[model samples]
Target: MNKQPSHASEFLWSTPDAFEETKIAAPGTNLELETGAAAGLYGAAEVGNNVQSVWDIASSPEMGAGEDIVVGQKFSIYRCDALLGQGGMGKVYLAYHTELARPCALKITSPGKLTRGDDLKVRTAEEARSAAALIHPNIVTVHALGEARGRQYIEMELVAGGSLKHLLRREGPLPTLQALRWMSAIASGMDYAHRQGILHRDIKPENILICGRGVPKLADFGLAHRIGRGEYIPRGFVCGTLPYLAPEVIQTGDHSTATDVYALGVSLYYLLTGRLPFYADSLEDFTQQILTAPCPEVRELRPEIPLNVAGLVSRLMAREASNRPSSGTEAWHLLNSVLGQLRDVQSILDEALGYDPTVSWIRCGEKYCVRVQRPDGRQQRVFIESSEHRSDEQLLLIYSVCCPAESSFYETALRMNAEFSHGGLAIREVDGAPHFVMVDTYPRGTVDSEELRKSVHEIAEHADQVEKWLTGEDRN
Candidate 1:
């Protein structure tokens, strides 16, 4: 609700090679690597090895020799058009299918800098397999995985709008309603993936891509792992963005549905505010704060945020995993419950006046102004707005102007107010001038379609009559 300074990153967090060898096998399989060898595999920031900032990767002008896939280069029936982005893992290009002429995102593996035994090609295939297995509307569709010129690649659906990180960087914090909608949709996709025994180990804003019309599609399964697998990673090997890593994952090298939910919670907090929950000068301090400190109340920064929504965010970012929502399904339901409590006046007005030829309305910011044509051919404009009373009760205020407030007409307006049975006569300032306004009030949460329709018609008719009687003109 407040316009805070933008802290969005211009570059994305590069996926480090530490997670390349992180085993992602089928369920019921035991995949184990020596702790000494894999000790820092997941600890990108802790290791301080190949963890490059977004700027470092974005500033690189060229890829390593034999790793660059040039534009217009035909590779396995796909023609590379332009480079979308490059990170520690690989370079993603906008490509097209030569035969079908279909556009897609072509992600090519960059295995030049990987550590020994870190088979990036195998990891790339695993990423494709893990993502391709589950098909959902919110999940980015993976088409195929192949190889050309010794470089492995994945073909995915091309999302034109780009990633959530880019969106936030360009357009600071989003509207609470729009952010909630996107979060709920992403939760549905995560629930589907969890049901299929997949854990999206990485669930940051950069990994979530936005499609046309604001549809959020979960992308980047590079760190995804199958559930129920024994010893999925060596202890102490953390594998996720430092800011979004769950406390349990940071303390113990474990990944679960709850961990994913924790990351989603952190992502939600970032969406609501323009910055992360905790900030520190170094990764160790940041990790320590996450492990020991309680998350600050979201409402502390954005007080206008609803209590339920703020509480949900707190629960999602609980230091203990057991306190979290458990899975995306639970989170989705909670988010929907909050969404259900929100009252959109514009939507209510639309439902009330959509089919009436004599009624037309336009929304300006949070308020709606409707023009109603009375049966007598006179037109009056009615305004509907949401306000909070001193008692903190949310109310819908409906009003229409009658005429300028003059000392001579004060007694007549008071007399008419007593005669009226619906709304009362009030003097409110309009364009810096006091005017006699016919005003009505209703509880925002309980205002219904029929009541809204009746009030709009009555207020318009009454205000038009008053204007004609007092001023003998059709001026508002």
Candidate 2:
């Protein structure tokens, strides 16, 4: 028997793992649960005192007029193979389409869950219609919508890689670069949807599905509202996961592009620090904190996070809706700018070597090389490479050729290495022959544009001088 949370809010707000045991309802049920009354009923209505042990009665086949859909169940041209997941809406099954011979996710609404004039049924249809209209690489594709045995069902693209929530649970906080990549992709997708006049009122980690290639696609448009179209919600009921809800949405029940941006920011924060910005024992305190408290600085929690990246998160999570990015377009641009600052080796090379005409660079396979012309019209080519020294340290290697290595030159090279100020001479194979090379290194993590520029210049000059001294020619 599992221990039940003391309050309904606790059960509703608990980590996703706690809800895993809660049986998945039948497919095609509306995904979003209207909070407050509905949430309390879900938490307390089923089992007497054993709240956690209570089965999800709303989605159970026993509660419905139709029989439970078991493995190998067929609905039209699709055949259900296994259970994928279950949420507030209903169960999702891994199904294969016989006509198209493709895999898809089948979501069926539990029979008897819908009553005459039930807004949930309308919203369920709207979710399918809304998602089916927008066909973007980052947004999940809805295949078809139909009814079987008095139950409504939706066929959607099967994203093999699980949700961001599952990723966070399996692997704690992600690496900074990887997290930024996923967020940037999500922002682009959201921007596209916003331009289509649709607002994803519910944006959270669980709703973002990653594919096998690691591309994240926005999903579950159950709470989506089209801009400029007045949508109605029952008074006092808010729709969205609590921790990711925006301040304005919590206070006034308004949904806008900025509200979506706020949720994306909160999701990014969760990805960077495996915890939400606000948490409390009760729903009242938690809502108050979102309404009034200042969002904690991201860097305060993870000091290594770039300052500008932290600033972007802070701007997105601003308490005032007006203080955040006006739209997904603005947020996408802001995210991309921050990505430029957290430079990789290639970006570092582009910054240091891209502008000058006197220097030319090319990438061959994984190795990068730059040819620099000395003041005397002599030319020297320097190679830059990256390698991991230990699990924690990534090293950037910069080397330039001096001359072919020879026994007679060994003693002089050793003596000249002592006289050099910046890089040292080492014998390395170059073009199937051993050559004396000038080498320098820096930790890739801490290396910057200015440092790379100085190293390249110094290494080029030293190697050119050594070549002139040993070979008496301009051979690299």
Candidate 3:
């Protein structure tokens, strides 16, 4: 018996497949439960964990309706092909006019999600009517508004390019100049609308649509109400996206042109940082933070952001609505003035190359040659090229850093290139030698001096990492 115990211990301790049994539950706890077989089924309402279902049934006599229109289904004159998007109150579908052979966006009301009264239907029609009154190049065109089978729907222009929100989600942040350009365009659109006595209370990124030509167009004027034209928004009736809501608007639910400016400023902040300034777990917390918290410095988050640009954005997002720009036109002019003081990319690069203590750049025809010393005491030649496509809105800046391309590191470079955030490494043959290179591109006019420096630093750091990896000396 002693030998047997010893043998068991040896097998348990030394064997590769041996494992200890583990127990998670209390030693004396009862885990078994009573069970029955072949029982008759009960109603869905009588099933397990039916508290929510029971509450739903007790609250309403009839449940809400499901999606009414499917693919190829005709609600009225329009044939629904695909669903573009949906919201709490309705869904926007891609539909085509049967008679006119035109494509349009059909927004239909979801009766159940809206108020029990006819307010939503009325508002849906009002939204169409309000937008229909305006005929601007930067506004979405509304064709018709009608009711079909007791459901309200509106047919409008089908904007091919998605909203700025989608782009912000894909790309972390935008270049300062590009963001300024888009903001200027939106301001121009809203200025025209304000002149027409329409107040766009909702002016967030989701409401700005980029067209095929990269031109920003103001959209979703559903929350718009005509001011100084006998249209009165009842006091204490708040209507706007919460994050962009002005302090006065949140406190009293009174929206004004200043409210739109505040929202535009918030949108600008979002475009510059790809995030909201204030975030909270609850509505109370959010309201408190937004109304009371001091605004964060934009340059702290993006040091590359120009001081004057940051100051303008900060002023636009001031807590007091009066502190903001009086009108969108005025804001546009302010941005133009600030932009006028900023140096062009070529000039900045030339200045960086000329007088910068750490870096040197020389004009070599259309391309600029930047000389950089790597950390390992190796010298690297980076070529900069700025090209403007005839159709592109901004100049494209390309930077290429050249190195000897080893076939063993070619695959690694390709992989790194695919995964890199700013740019990628490539293997190009130059005079019978494989040249390993890293390439990055940025918009020319938008790349500020600080941003340019950061890009160069990032490229240099990446080149160092690549060289180390190639030499099998990578410590990371």
Best model number under TM-score: 2
- The runs of at least 3 residues in candidate 1 whose Cα sits more than 4 Å from the true structure, single-residue gaps closed, are 1-63, 111-119, 230-235, 344-476
The CA lDDT of each predicted structure is 0.69, 0.72, 0.62
Candidate 2, TM-score vs. the true structure? 0.65
Candidate 3, residues 93-160, lDDT tens digits: the string is 77899989998877776545334555545555565687788788777777898877666777778777
* lDDT by residue (tens digit), candidate 2, 60-87: 3444455778879787788988766544
TM agreement with the true structure for every prediction: 0.62, 0.65, 0.59
lDDT of 1 by residue, 1-476 (tens): 11111222311233343321122222112111111111111112222333343323433443464456678898789998876655444566778999889998777755442322344445556657877998998888888988777666778877776567557777987777668778877888999999999998778776777776657888777667779854443333355666777877766557789999998998899888867888775445666788888788878888888888898789888888888999988877767666656757877787778888999988878788899988878899999998765322467899999999989888877877787778888889999999999999876644556788999888888888778877889986
TM-score of 1: 0.62
lDDT of candidate 3? 0.62
Alpha-carbon shift of residue 20 in model 2 (angstroms): 14
**What's the CA RMSD for each of the models?**
14.5, 14.1, 23.0
